[model samples]
Target: MCGIVAATAQRDVAPLLIAGLKALEYRGYDSAGLAVLDGGQIRRVRAKGKVREMEALYRADPFPGGTGIAHTRWATHGVPNEANAHPHVAGRVAIVHNGIIENYADLRARLQAGGRAFTSETDTEVIAALVDERLAAGLDLREAVLAVVRELEGAYAIAVIDRNAPGRVVGARRGAPLLVGLGIGENFLGSDAQALVQVTHRVIYLAEDDVVEITRESVRIHTLDGTPVERPVHESELSADAVERGEYRHYMQKEIFEQPRAVADTLEARLGPHGVLPNIFGAGGDELLAKVRGLHIVACGTSYHAGLVAKYWIEEYAHLPVGVEVASEYRYRDAVVPPDTLFVAISQSGETADTLAAMRESKRRGYLGTLAICNVPESSVVREADLRLMTRAGPEIGVASTKAFTTQLAALALLALQLAHQRGLDADRYAGLCAQLAHLPRAIEDALALEPAIVALAERFIPRQHALFLGRGVQYPVALEGALKLKEISYIHAEAYPAGELKHGPLALVDESMPVVAVAPGGPLLEKLKSNLQEVRARGGELIVFAEGEAGMDGNPARGALLRVASGGDFIAPAVFTVPLQLLAYHVAVLRGTDVDQPRNLAKSVTVE
Candidate 1:
């Protein structure tokens, strides 16, 4: 369940729907399809891979309907095949859904027992069946959706069109994101603003339990219980140009190169000449920091790696004890929330299912308050959290996050600096950290300049099956992130270990067959890290070392590979080092002929558990 696009227009909406689905393609999907209510029947086109296939299919035999629903599905209940794709139809209804339907088995059994036949093996198909059953029971399209949603259990955002009704679309959201796009004598619905960016910039972000019906001329909203409601319309600043991959070969590469500008955008105005302005987290942010004695940062995937780095920064500078945990695991355990401990959830989309659940669980467990560090300003996490820090990463369409990860680091750094100042960090030291934040953009730009070297280095990783990454202290997380980048894009099996923990069973796997990539930055632990690299070299392991501006390797090893990242002291090296790693993965994937932007078996955001 990944992307959805539907529209009711005065003109032929097939091209508009196709364009919307194409815009959401970066979210990652294995199958794509769209169904238009043509004349009195549903016309369908389904393809197993890219949206181009379906678009071509539609071009050969066009169905000129003013209303349609489209989907790019990342298979949940079935395999990635055309038969399992969305725009699933049943009786009078055709639907596209994004999110899991937990009670589908129960509903499928009940429907089958009642003589309703099933086709595809998707939970989304069950939804189509349910909505069709309600429609057949004499309810209108909107009523059918409201009734079907109440009977359903699980997270979902569904858009439906009745074969009997023209110029209309019914949409409902319980967990996943859904919004209505307003236009002149036309309206649209999609999973996110990016999908609607081509046709409209104004939208209504649907709240949980919101059911909306949009036609060419009007929009109506209500709850599952039939109570009428009004949702605010938000004018989106997102543009179609932001998602285009201008000069880069792939979205992953483009986003990797965008880190410098993205980080600068994140830190813009958030830092003053002296230090962090503190109010960047929103109004009353300073008072919120004053009460915080500790932090519990919860996130997942690359965001979890960012949280780990933030723990190092906040503890080292603010003197605050920080506990970082993966969001999926944080809620499963009986947490011990210490007094004045702020619960922080970080996400690029800010709609990660596990992180949101953990944040909710934290409230019941009694934390000081919740803070959301997110990229999307209107996401659920930002709307629900007591405080917020928006990471201005723009739209990170690639599944293997590049600029988003670095921007999260940039945002978390500001959070750390603000807290450090509250702990009475020295003026000179504090100003130095601020100065480093200001220099991060140039440092990243320098790292991006290493692309040719990284491109040459990619040839080495293409033939490799596995990799080992190493770092020490703050850079340990950097190593983990580097390993993640390689494994994500190149599909190379990789692992990371603190340079201090190489002998703790990881050393046994080191050999000439396995390359060891190390983030060897100049710091107090540089000597220790160098010794660790020596151990890998002794084991005959090929070494790829990213040193800090020629400082870590004075007498360079003739047998090893070395690339330098522009250093900006110790405060912002993590974000800087991340650039080459992203470039490394992108180039490796390109050489290996892999899907660099939409990696296999991965989506941009984890909206489902």
Candidate 2:
């Protein structure tokens, strides 16, 4: 993923563009650059590193202009370096792009055959050069952009500016996020709302195949064929303070403690008296629920683990046969998704490349209907899905994801109950689960208070290079998510295995140096989980056992630390058990002095496949 920001203003736009880029840097920070029109020519400056490096470069030799485009790149086709940075220029035209061009090789060959020279090793530069070549053949800027788009393939959100057009900029998107911010005497364009939050909260989300022409005074929208179209501008609910870290030491920790509030917010509009679930999907949900032959849950990373947990809830409560697949691998497998099958795509950021692609594939094959459980409103997944369930986790900044994952589980559990209700499952059973769901936020609050013990354990084990996470039943996915958070931020080699699977092969890796974090809540799987923990202890692996209430094992206080989470029923236990693991990972990463917000080799959003 990469970040792009463009502005056309009556006054100097460099500072505004830079500030916007800084806000969007969480998307990508491999290299940053800006291109501005100066004295009838495109002037550019770029650097490979953090945004601060580029800011220093700009201050040293500024690009003077009232209109410009900027980018923070996460390199895809080229290595991260100054030369590979964005704002790739050709003649007097400059371009900054996010998303991949699948047919760049063929397009580049054609351009090279036409004697067009390239300055950088980027697919984006190809777009710039193609536009320049088209303009050289007497086509205007808009026509050239249209022609180049016709020749290009794959996903892209591109913003281009030409010195010839002066204070004008053009942008288009296909499979990536792009928004137009409306302001007085100026208009802005960026990959997301974060970039424009400082300027305005009024935004128009650009749809696929839509092109926008932005001028200093106004923004005009049109289809690829130059047909005028009306796009609705909505006021963003995002507050400037929402993006701040507040009193927390890091965004990760803030997000960890935000779980209780996030879960409560997600349940706000979906629940009523007596724990009744709202009909979010409308009457169509009834038809889809009735015709469903099977349920397929598709997602990636932490969302995938959430889906694994949903599979348990859906099958157990709704009595539906369920299949959980990683979104990236799901589309390629030979598994049959019949016409009556219901495909549920779970993604915190609805723009996740693999999950969106999987949704498209499911629709192409005529699945009954596709549903999206997403955090961001107006995201591509939410727009394309036949149904939507929005999570109110509000802007999870940490790359490892804390609040979003828990909120997704909360929403999905509600969905599972709603489906069970529609399926005519026993009313008392569904109501009991709903009552448990209502207490989850408070359970999470009690769970979060165990941070001191988790932090102490983290201090003891942060230097360790490897760890193992174990759980049984629904808690297994919590184990996976915990291991994922540790590995993602701490750069530790962590593995999550089902407690039953430990003796199969993972037992060989156990030792004194390896920490075994087991989810041993008092549930149906407690005895099996204890057996697994005993196996690890017998192998001399350090134990970090998370259980409910006071249940201490004998004579192993030093070698092992036990966290007694506030007791909850089995239905809500996963939500409670998740908090301490999140804390442990956050503390470990902090103790190791890792970049928790923008982890190495990762971006907040995965906009590319």
Candidate 3:
């Protein structure tokens, strides 16, 4: 994923664009660039590093213009360098793009045949040159964009500004995220609302194949065929504080602690004192729930782990057969998504490339109903789905997700309870679980107090090159997420194994140098988890246990550290127990001197496959 921000007829927009880019830097930080229409010519500046570096470069050689487009790139087709940065310019056209053009090689060959030269080895540069070629052949900016898009085949959100049309910017999205911020006098375009939230909260989320022509005072929407279309502009209720880190050392840490507030927010206004969902989805819910034969939970990364936990919840409570698939793999497999099957996509950013693509495929295949559990209200996933469950985890700034994952679990758990009620499952059991769910925020607050101990534990393990995480049942997904967070930020060689699976193959790697983080929550699997911990301890592996406050350790001297979560009911423990693991990863990464906000080789959003 990359971040894009464009503004037309906005004087001194560079500073604003930079601020927006900084807000979006979590999405990408490999390189940053900006292109402004200056004196009827394109003026571009780029830096090979973070947004701050680009800001310094731009300040030294100011590219003053009223209309501009900026990008913070996550390297895809090329190395992370100034030459490979976005706002790729070709002749009079400058372009900033998110997503990949799969047919770029063929397009490059055809363009080379036409004697078009390329500078950077990026698929985005090909788009800029193609637009430039079309513009030279008597097509206007919008016409050229449409023509070029016709030749492309891939997911992309392209925003172009031509020197000849200094006041106009054309943006097109095909299976990628693009939003138009409805501001006074000056209009804005960004890959996400976070990029434009500071300037305007009113936005129009562009659908696939929708092209927007933005000028100083007006925004026109049209189909690829040039027919004018109407789109709804919605006001976002997101507050400025939602995006702030407050007093935490890093956004990751702040997000870890915000899990309590976020979970509370997701549960608010929907559930009553009796633990009933307030008929939110209405008639659609009944119709869909009645006919649903099975469910396909599609997501990527941490969201995928959430779906794993959801499978347990829904199957146990809702009595529904559920399959949790990695979105990227789900589309290509011979999986069955019947007409009455419910397709649920989980994503924090909502612009997750594979998840969005999988959702589209499910719709094309005629899934009964599509639902998106997302954090962003009007994100592509939310807009495309028939029903939306918005997680109230506001702007997750860390590249490796923390609060968003927990919030998604909280929302999905509630949805499971709702489904259980509709399906006439054990109502009392479901109600008890819901009551526990309601107390999760407070349990999470208590869990967050373990951070100081976790930070101390992290100091002993951050320097280790290899680590392993193990858990059983629902905690397996948390173990996977914990391992992922460590690998994502700290560059540690970490792997998660369902405790039972360790004996199959992974036990061979356990040694003195390997640190094993075991999620041994108090449950039926507690003894098995303890046995697994002992297996690691027998192999001279360091052990870190995440257990309840009263969990008995059986006097194992090998239990190097214990992160005791506050005592809570079993149903709420996942939400609360996840807090310490998130802090452990964050503190470890920070101690390793890694960029905690924008991790290397990772972007906040997975907008491209």
Candidate 4:
């Protein structure tokens, strides 16, 4: 996980590069640096901490240049220090890189043997040395870059600049994402289109192993092996306002409240007059759903929880066998991919490293088709899939996902309805589910309105050290998600279990210091969940329940502790139930004085394995 921004423009581009790096800072902010080519030399400034530190250093003594490259690094090769930050320089070549170079040791040894010295403990410096050696050995800047790229042994998206070539910037991508931003009398490069959206909406997403060379006036693309290629410049639909916090205290809170709109946006096109059609997932989605023999849902983190929820919906409604797996474990294992199985990848940022890798593995193992339910239209996962469903959650900047997760559930619900329609489901049942889907936005709004109560619920947990969450059947994943949210933000040790499993093991951990939160959706399992809550009460544990209003525990003494969450329908109740849990975690984190947006040791996107 890292970020890169480069530009060659008609005027001083250092400010532009700084702004782009600041925008991409969510990707990673461990260390930041910039290299700008001025009158016949490359000047670089690197710092060990947040982007603001680099910004301060630059402001103290500015380095302005017409062409430059900047990076915010999530450290992989060495400790995050000035020496280990990006913008590593050798000879006249300066480079900023995102991915690991597997054979960096060998290349470093070769370069060192050739009398090339390295100043930083990074794989990027090795590339710089190799390119510098090539340039020294009678090759032009672009020629040296292409030559060195041919010998690279691992995934990397890099931007290189040569002092001799003052007006040019060379960029290459193999695995990590890279894109070019188009503008009049200027051109730009970034790890994602979001960084450049403020500068230009027109972008060309570079394919795997594509090398691009950009100048002040023109842009050219070539294959890694020197073959010229043409790539379409698509207009990015995300606006600068989407990434802003507006009046919200934090991006996470803004995203959490945006659930109502996010779910509505996701369901906007899917709910048509003829009930749920399959074309929402691009062309041939209906055909794929009809022919699918089984389904494998793959994702990581919050996306994995969404897939787990989908497993319940797909199997119950579509009546097909569905297996959900964490993308990290799924990619490494020799998973059984049944013939004609539709491999589904769910990710908020389609560039999630593990999820994308799992999707590629599914393709390699001959899955019938690959489907990606992702928010970003030009994400690597969407591009790799044969069928794609774009979740209209737009740009989710928070490290802890909120809107993205809810919108994914909406998309998955539509997919399940389409599959059920193909499997000859009863018309009344189909129409009911469609209406439930339509009601989700309003239900989520009602849940958001209950925030003041959830805030009070959160206050009770401020002194608690650990917690347990319980639910049965379809709501079990909701419990898991609740536990995940609590742990992610508030730094509380929380665990979730099926209500029945509390007696088997988890009950032992319940005590006065440990709180128990239950997701009690009014379902067939309601009585069983009530019994489980009684067990927690008997164990002298404080209980917090996110329950449906008509669950009929009306006169119970736990009413003070129980907060009612809205239900769109039994099918879409999970999305509504998610709101209170998210708010609880957010408010608790605020009270605990922890960083809600940038939690420690976590980056927004896991772009590296």
Candidate 2 per-residue lDDT, tens place, 244-294, comes to 889998888999888999999999867775665556755476567667767
lDDT for each candidate structure: 0.89, 0.87, 0.86, 0.88
User: What TM-scores do the predictions have?
Assistant: 0.98, 0.97, 0.96, 0.96
Instruction: Give candidate 2 regions above 4 Å deviation.
Output: 549-552
Candidate 4: stretches off by over 4 Å = 549-560
Q: Give the TM-score of candidate 3.
A: 0.96
Question: What lDDT tens digits, residue by residue, belong to model 3 across residues 418-450?
Answer: 888878877678678878888888888888888
For candidate 2, the 10 contiguous residues with the lowest summed lDDT are 549-558
Q: What is the C-alpha RMSD, rounded to one decimal, of candidate 3?
A: 1.8
- In candidate 3, the residue pairs with backbone N, CA or C atoms under 3 Å apart (3 or more residues apart, or in different chains) clash, namely none
Top-scoring candidate (TM-score): 1
Superposition error at 32 for model 4 (Å): 1.3
**lDDT-based ranking:** 1, 4, 2, 3
